[model samples]
Target chain A: MQRSPDDLTLSGDEQIAGEADRPFARSLPWLLLVGGLVGFAAAFTLTVEKIALLRDPDYVPTCSINPILSCGSVMRTPQAEVFGFPNPLIGVAAFAALAAIGAAMLAGARPRPWFWAGLQAGVTFGVVFVHWLIWQSLYVIGALCPYCMVVWVVTILLFWYVTLVNLGRTRAGRLLAEYHAVALTAWFLLIIGLITVRFWDYWSSLI
Target chain B: MAFKSPQNTTASGARAKIDAARAQDRRRAARKRNMTIVASLVAAFAVIVAVFLAVDPGSGPDGDTLAAGESRYVRSDSHRLTTAADGKVTLVEFLDFECEACRGMYPLVESLRKEYEGRVTFVVRYFPLPGHFNAERAARAVEAAAQQDKFEIMYQRMYQTQTEWGEKRTPADEYFRGLAQGLGMDMAAWQKAYEDPATLARVKKDVADGQALGVQGTPTFYLNGTLVQVQMQDDLKKAIDAALAG
Candidate 1:
């Protein structure tokens, strides 16, 4: 069913109008395409590694560098399977959906407001879940998994921009859209600082 | 008082209608703009990540960082495996006496020390974790043993009897004293050293050095200047062999 363009949520600013429309509209699909690929690769590899460990208990994950930086330690923890299945499995499905949605949008599919809303909800869960995983990794698990860190980085970026775009029609989103990079940089620095502090022993030692 | 013709009134009405028609295009235009901004945001983030990786000091595969220097590695000088520090290779271990992993790798390390006795200068540094009840005390006891030139004897003693007092909450000071007595160590001197603040200071310094070198857990080893990222015994051996070869 075709609706008027105004009916679609996440379609951004009215003031710029025809002057800036077509070029910007064409770039969303590419945005999703890049984020989805990196995120998918990280999840896919983690799942494969987990499966390998399960198949052979003696198998050491390639990412297990030491006691402080070990993927194998993270994978064995119960939190890695919070939903009674490996968390990376969820990442696989979500990233695929993200890529598909991006491709469709690129192909001129104008998803209803509900689709954007659902994506917002999903990524909200993702951002929260990943932060919790970061906490568990640093405070509880006492190790950093390389692939999982990649997922964490992408998930934060995905959630931030997703929320920004989804609120495209709102005054708040528009204002935020102006300083999008600043907010993202703040979020990145916070996480990076936390990681640096938590593994200070390891990080400082590197230098 | 100015006369308004029907033509003027009709023109005004048409202008309002045109404005109303333009309103319908606003949402489409808004979505287009938002998408573009979102896309640019993602692209910017990707660029940031790219820049970070480019400048990342530890840029090897699997996030393997470059090794720290050897200038500040040692503090206590008594716990070397070889008498002379003239060996081509210097292997440093940050160990906790009460750790199971340390206990597990003890025999392997002992054999490796024997195997590379002359070629490698093995240095042991105390890095007792807070969780282990007797680890710090054990380190002090070893330092005390070093006073009598019996550091290796105490080292072998603690690991050998790790099962008896390793994870126990009760202090193993009495058990350690018995071993020291059996080895003919002067009980008074060893006791005084155990209580010496200097003994604890030595452990703390080693712990700090280990942290500075990014060592988080016990039994962290460095082959020459590089941290040995060992998953198995062979990994340590391979690193050591490479250093020895070089």
Candidate 2:
């Protein structure tokens, strides 16, 4: 008996999902792996060295040249503490969670609904923190924390990736598909340019 | 022939059910998206509240004087010199007499003193930035007035009429004479005090004290003994609340 296109159906044995799912699932693994590695390394380095460097006055190991570029000057000030605690502790916990998330993604595990929600929460936190740190560095402390700045960059990238992936899985997939790559690249360049302009004086002084 | 017709009918029925299921899935996804947007907005609001609570612990029962201790001053001397008595919150200002920023901050300082009254004390210190040529001489003229208990009047008048006296048009001695007349100082005593080398040394000492406490620029204020780096009103309030709590 002949069948129409609407009526036709593959047998259970012949059914297979498309390559679209395969690529989409695999993309996350690479992102998580790289993000995890970078986050772990950056967090570990800052946690170990930056805190110790702050407590010691005579142990300046370069990087403290101009008044504005001086990490020692900024770190020594009371503005470094938001709630009587160093903000980098938040960074350590956040990066650690990101690394765990990345590992889970690498294992081919589909995140539960709560996992996506948690990720969205984290990205929001990161966005707030990055802007706060930038404001403090620019107008308040008038000096940048070198290692903390690196963490800020990585956190922003990780946030962008998480947002894109979440958007792709949800009903807003079309919006994500249209602007994800362009938005990410544009943001990356904008931040890099801002940092460059901020330290222009230090660069010129060296030259 | 009858079985063939029934089979076609069943096939069409199954196809219709499948289409309906897909449509339902699309509606469910849309609902989920709407829910997520609502949840995200709620979460954003919660975060803002949390941040506010985290930054400002609130003003306790101690009132404005306790709150004033947390305000950012330009330098520690501004606080130390301004406090009328031990345990009192003070707003100390270390200023260059010729600094434009200092001139601007003068009225704000005056208003704060009036507003806070006995709860806070306002102390003025000389911190002439080396870049301004006339700042040192201007600082000395104010110190000379302070010898006769007219420093505050002269200090305010110098800033009020900063354009006439602070810039290069008028000579330092001539400006001092003008300030003395405006403040109703005894001219003979004012002239003798203005020329006193000791008065200049006292102004120099205030500048030295400001530098020792990390005063980087003019119009620096010290709330209590802590060096304030930011000048925003909310930040100042937050610091004051924290100090009051302490």
Candidate 3:
């Protein structure tokens, strides 16, 4: 196995130590594949809905179940088209690329560092954009689209795992990698907490 | 083999080194396995707790199907035009101050407020329509006035003088600031609250609540959790009267 210069920085005696303790590293491609496909499906669904909305002005989307969960309301807003085109179009392309990359990686393709760096950048953008959308959905838009939420969850997981993989050469990174599941669980809990708190009235009334 | 040392010594030394490395690997793997098990158990326990709390089996809605929809009608912070001590009926109005339709309904709403008095709670919500040039600014001004115990005066002032600044392309912020001054509000404090992002957020919160209640236009009224269809001016009165009757 060809080791990079970063791998040599570890203790001399434990030359191959970091490589062996990487079961989490092995699961990266699986997360990418699954997350990417999930995100892709959501984005594609949103795109189709967007097209339908354009075709007929009064088209109520299938995902718009209630006022709080209304995609129809969100789709009509300018924020849905930040680039003068529907945001889901970007999602469709990016998620499709992610799925292809995951497939390549799963097929034992060892790409270069720059390639990983690029993927990291893409996911970083995706995660940041997803969070912005979350803020908009909860705060500004005052609504949530069910499909958009599916995309949010997958994007968060993909970003977390991709970041961990990119930094796996560092000691701190390896330590974090070991506690990956715990950290991920905590992150998800935090988001769930935010959603619960933000829509406390709506949620409480259901009981 | 290439070191040219005694073969047995070299072989034994290599074997010991391999054994030590394997032991370290086993220990590390075991620790990770244990940690993962503990973490998983904790996570599973948390999920179960959340599910239990969410279900709350015995205390669920009691067959009141409209409970969820009813919750959206009024929030604790919603402005009370009139509050009754034992009010069984709630009248929520999502309005844009600069909206002509809302202006048209203002007198009727005022009369209703007077007639209902202590029998119902008249709740006002800010829902500035995007098409209205000064609707949000007007709401912020009203909210800022509200902070100073002058909500009614400023609300009255907006409707009374809405024609002076309504539907112009230019922002009516200066006009609202002047109105704030005219209302005997402390200028420094009023200005501070007016410009505060939190004030805008507060107004937006109402707008958000309105949106969640499926309010797509100004002058939308909810009479006792039921959306009232106001085809004519009399419909609002009829709805309120019917709610009061029940």
DockQ for all candidate structures vs. native: 0.05, 0.03, 0.06
Tens digits of lDDT, candidate 3, B1-246: 122334587776776677667756854986687678658866786786578656643222111233333355776667899997787889999999999989999999999899889988999999999898789889999999999999999999999999999989777878999999998899888987775545766787677667877898989999888889999879988887787788
Model 2, A1-207: lDDT tens digits are 333232223333221222123213456656656765676676666555566775653345355543445555555556656768766667777777777777776675566557767987887888777787777776655566666666777778777766665554343654653445545555665665565456443333232
Of the candidates numbered 1 and 3, which has the greater DockQ value?
Answer: 3
lDDT of 1 by residue, B1-246 (tens): 222334676776785466447653654665566667656766775576556545664432112343443344553352786632465788888999999999988898898888888888888988999899889888989889998999998999999988998988777888888888988999999986775544655566677667878889989988777888879878877887899788
Number of the top TM-score candidate: 3
lDDT of 3 by residue, A80-156 (tens): 99889999998999999999888897998766667878999999999999999988878876777899999899999
Residue B205's lDDT within candidate 1 is: 61
TM-score of 2: 0.40
Q: Name the lDDT value of residue A106 in candidate 3.
A: 90
What TM-score fits each model?
0.50, 0.40, 0.53
Q: After superposition, which runs of candidate 2 have C-alpha atoms over 4 Å from their true positions?
A: A1-25, A61-70, A169-172, A204-207, B1-246
Which regions in candidate 1 have their CA more than 4 angstroms from the true location?
A1-25, B1-246
Task: Give the Cα error of residue A121 in candidate 3, in Å.
Answer: 0.6
Backbone clashes, each candidate: 11, 8, 0
lDDT winner between 2 and 3, please give it.
3
lDDT of 2 at A114: 73
